[model samples]
Target: MAEPLSSLSLWPIGNCQVSALIDDAAGLVWGCVPRVDGDPTFCALLGGERQDEGVWRLRLAGQVSATSQYRRNTPMLVTRLEAEDGSAVDVIDFCPRYQHSGRMYRPVAFIRIIRPVAGNPRLEMLLTPMHHYGTEAARTTRGTNHKRFLIGDHQLRLTTDAPIGYIDEGRSFRVEQDLHFFLGPDEPFTGNVAHSIRAMEEATELYWQSWVRGLATPMDWQEAVIRAAITLKLCQHEETGAIVAALTTSIPEAPHSERNWDYRYCWIRDAYYTVQALNRLGALDVLEKYLAYLRNIVDRAAGGHIQPLYSVMGFAELEESVAANLAGYRGMGPVRIGNAAWTQIQHDAYGQIVLPTVQGFFDQRLFRMADERDFESLESVGEVAWKMHDQPDAGLWEFRTRQLVHTYSAVMSWAACDRLGNVAERIGRPERASFWKDRAAKIRARIEAEAWSDEKQHFGAAFGHHHLDASLLQMVELRFIRADDPRFQSTFAAIEMALRRGEHMLRYDSEDDFGQPETAFNICTFWLIEALHMCGRSDEARGLFETMLAHRTASGLLSEDLDFESGELWGNFPQTYSLVGIINCAGLLSRSWDTVR
Candidate 1:
């Protein structure tokens, strides 16, 4: 296996409906057209012998190098390709997202505008879209000013101002008028290509800037928070409001380790954290959207039993399978689609589903505040949590080879009932509130009695399992146990002793279905920082937070795993969990805005 030259110089541009990842040189290295979970239209980043097939590249005939950046406060990406002879071109890429008609019109389309910025710059356009994950080429047909690609059952029309034949042949052409390309629906582009694209670019820019203005970000690291918030927002499947775990999947957690798993689906745990992170910045649109998603999910559950995850479109069944179409990321092989975790009974989800949606009952600013009907639906989820709080199932680490009454799951279940109690009161349901509060008390009492090891003087991962899991740090965050509690203090010490490796922390060092994890789980480290801050180690937490910031890619993004020793990023790209960590830690450690004024 070989490492990709595509540096994590990876940048993202999207309209809520679709997302595209571009390389530093303005090549569309990876993207799921029409939808985030849809088939990959350009998948070189996943790796194979035929990576060039699904890629879209804009080559400056004699280019030396290029530099890229997002237009401030917008998803628009610009790449300046400078040729050795001093000629250059600026390639601007964005997916139009703005208000049109009475509603938001975030089309599942990508728009690229190219213009020569320096002397006589020449350009070569190469767009080779593939189907079935690069197993077959897309059938093509040419039109007057457009080209249609028959990708699987769908027809994608690419309307461009550049000569169709010239683009198809990858021929060098002198730069003249600004060239605009829109690849989306099969419907004919109804307006002038250049004019419509220009208008879209302007509107999209204004849309993102205005969206950012609404954020109540911490005074420090506002840019990083905004970017992560925007990326998190892009993961949302707006039609149903399901938030995906990440944009790309099957990127191995560590090199050639069989850890690559599809992440384009929605996990209750992941969506909860994603919602919580964004909500902290006052991004209520996501919460309001996801709150409806949760309500629909609970409405469909049988006896209040919900799976760990679901398809972004809210489908119940997501049978896992491997795609033989292309070799895995860096040819690691066994590219997987559809996560099997969807079938697992992760008891933690009952709590995860409850935590975010309950906010609507209390928050005054929501357009459609939750009502008693919503509370009825949520009470069913709490019922499940009460029934399974101590029952065996997959824990948050999602171990496949074992089942235990995971302490984290019990803790989350406790949180679910606890918050429901608070929400029931807010909604004026005194009897329901007392019922929930009593159940929450009983769950918490059992967790303390069974999960705590008096001899070890620390909390274990499960009822009797002495193994340390980093999730113990979440106790403080959940308010289940105060950071200063002696039990929590000892559990925190135990986790650091058992899992911490220098500045990094592992979720667990125990071997699982795929052997022991070699890299540090990115978010686990953030949990440690937050734990440290709450425990009055604020200076140390601040120092570690600074160190983690230095580890972010040029894009200020991170994947799921980082090398505990070398700090190399691995796992799914633009991992939602990892980005949420950045947002949370920055908020936790930054100096207060009050002193700024």
Candidate 2:
């Protein structure tokens, strides 16, 4: 079977509402319909004999070869396949997303425009949209120009310019003029489908290019930063501003490793880093939208309690279960649906929630600046951090079987109170500032006293164990400890000693529920890259960052995990965390703007 997730070289196109991963052959192999979290309408990415259930394939009757590329700087993908008879078809796949009306018209749709590129090409279209994780295919009925598919409570209409009989009967026909298909809601398509798609393509290209133009790129590594930034933006759900961790789930970290888990939900820690990275590029549009998402989350948590992750729609309950109907990535079993980590007590989220929102209180350029009430609402988060700083829960790792009083969690908790105090002072609330300042100081004292390992001369993963983790690098980021501090330096060296694998870095060297990790977590390598720069290893850091850049996919994307030994990407596709790493490292290590002259 194909390693559908990483193999076949999948390219993704999304409108922030729906996303699809297509194979180089122009097959709609992996995509969820209606929404990113919805049931798989194209589930062939995860292996199964059920290709007729959740996949769309466009092929020439005698097709022998294919190649793919994205349109210049835009997410539009073009795949050309040449048949043995010297005939070819170019498949253009994109999700229609441009400003429609006064608001963004990101309807749930996948648009494909196919054109004959060579002599007498014959095209065959197999659109098998499945429901309930590919357990069954939907019932289809047809009109003169459209086919309506009924899947559970949803109705999908596939409007096209081709002969309806040819599509319904799977008949191969001679290629003629341009053919367009729009698979979305069951409503009637208003105008000429082909003309509308052509217009949407032009508008979509303009939208992406214009968005790219606003990015504040560094003098060096301009292309890498742009691609990474664009991928990160695609992770955001435009309807609600919640950014997902990745577009996929169940892509294992290593071969047959059940480390395969769902990454379709929003993790507070991941979103904070994403915003921080985009904020450096002056993409306050993302940060500002995310701040609103953060505020919604905080408001929904009327009490002090909060989850480490939530659905893209901001729902809290995400019960995890194995999808028995489908095989996992590369035929790995037990593909998972919802993430269980949402219930884990990752205390670091408190800091992350406050960290991004605090920027709004100070940044004047934002249209909707945060006010006094926002700061007060944020204090409630600080109080939770103050209460939970020393308590034991799942660390950022989300260990399925164990819990520990993680040093990283305590420091982040301290950061929460620390930022709260800063925001309070900025808003002229001296008394509130004093209160949070005192709390932050006390939390810092506890972290300093308990998390330190005198024998090892470094901080540990937890209060007792001297095991070093790459997460400790955030000590400098959270400002809990200065980078030059001997303790932090020792910790950095210690983590590198244990977790560094040649040019790559692992989250840790220890065993978890799935046994020891065989692949380097891609984001951890970037953390090491940033740490090296801060520690005055600028040349080594630059060399390492460039090496990591070489590992990106053909489309200039990264996954959650990397097999350093083999130089193969693993885990979920187009991981936002990995993309954030690229943006952050490029910004940190780029040559000074003054030297550009």
Candidate 3:
């Protein structure tokens, strides 16, 4: 049960709480609370010397073998433990988001479920929510109609519908059996105990089920697709529809590398492709909201400038800050919030942001609601698109070192102009159409003449560098160049030859790149998937797609990078952008497979 002491992740069907078992031998960590990124309340992940934050353990129980899983198509988590006494305890966990409970940036509901599967099991409940990753303790007490606790700015209110007993530990309390626990911060849940639980569960289920049904994927890989789908939905900040890169912030690319970066904000570039992927899956309700968010941002900027990323609520003032109190993930230090890279201008971001909005507008049937106002907002995007060619700033990677005329950036700049021209021509804006066409033609000419390194047989990462970048592969995807175009073919081949590591492709071979340079970028690999299909290597593309699919973790989760040697997922877990890439690539491959058959 305990392997030199480690952690295990589990999902139980029809349960909402995702449990991470810290000590299987002791059966010490049980009935865990709301979520993974939540305040540990009970965590041994941070430090040691028998120190853990908040945990409810079955203290009287001895060593046990445990397994956990979620109900099919639901967030419910059931953790099963078989004890040394031949007794079994089934902990059913769920924190149902109540009706209209999906706003991700706000404090939300979390449910814990417990049931006796095989035997009458006795359990001890302990609540210890340590502040700042268990660095500080919350003041605790029992209030009328509420078990209230506060630490600095965080206020926790626990309400139980059943009779409960409590003992105060250093941090939280130990509770008796037969109780339903409701845990949330200052943003209160509606009503008390049972009413709140029912509402939250109904809302969360409705939100999730509605999303799942909308996806067009069949049952062949249904569970995998559903898990991936939920992960993607979780990333969307429900209020603004700004899809965060991930829920957690400041997880390092490499342990002790100081390469930590905050990804909670939405990147303009990531949003574009994500929109396309969601559109392909027929998940446009959320996609349209995101597009509207982008529209609002464009209107607000008024052509002054657009950020490469923004906060979940569309706040543009995202200056990076470090949380010095909490220890970094695995000691990869400097847990940061807000991304400084927001100020860096990635020219490709403009096209990536605009094209997806346009594509989603036209392709997804859900966008049948497109009206004159939508088109007007799009015209504003065209005005912003024109700014791409004039700007020379950091390219797609948002590199901190230096800014250059990245060829991929140029390709995207060209794409924005070209897409704007298409939209303008369709909407009868002939003058605007002509202007965009002229700019597009110029971008094409500039890329062919300046971006190509005939001597190196490929396009450069940046103009005159002669180095290949994985992003140049986008030239084909964005139609900056035709798939069979000699330059594009040569560039793709060159990237495969130079940047390819086994079946995976690297972003670029920059020495300054972080994360040990051992893994392929999840997004870049997906780019290769599309590129392979475009270049008529359909079989190879399909094979690589299958291989990448195999790389997903056992729970159908995927991280930002794949360690080639050890095959460990690195960077953030359940990365939405990477999964979006998977959807786009899979949809393309599915189409290709149909064509071949």
TM-score winner: 1
Q: What do the candidate models score in CA lDDT, each in turn?
A: 0.87, 0.87, 0.63
TM-score for each candidate, following the candidate numbering: 0.98, 0.97, 0.85
Per-residue lDDT over 250-310 for candidate 2, one digit per residue giving the tens place of the 0 to 100 score: 8888888888889998899999999899988888888878888888999999576779999
Instruction: Give all candidate RMSDs, comma-separated.
Output: 1.6, 1.8, 4.7
Sort the predicted structures by TM-score, highest score first: 1, 2, 3
* Candidate 1 overall lDDT versus native: 0.87
Instruction: Report the Cα lDDT for residue 427, model 1.
Output: 84
Q: What is the lDDT of candidate 2?
A: 0.87
Model 2 segments beyond 4 Å from truth? 1-8, 49-52
Tens-digit per-residue lDDT, 184-287, candidate 1: 99998988888999999999999999989998888888888888888898888888899999888898888889988999989999999999999998888998
Count residue pairs with overlapping backbones in model 2.
0
- Quote the lDDT for 443 in model 2: 91
- Encode model 3's per-residue lDDT on 70-142: one tens digit a residue: 5556555556767577656565555554344344322443455444555555555555556655566677777
- The runs of at least 3 residues in candidate 1 whose Cα sits more than 4 Å from the true structure, single-residue gaps closed, are 1-7
Model 2 residue 375 distance off true place after TM-score fit, in angstroms: 1.3
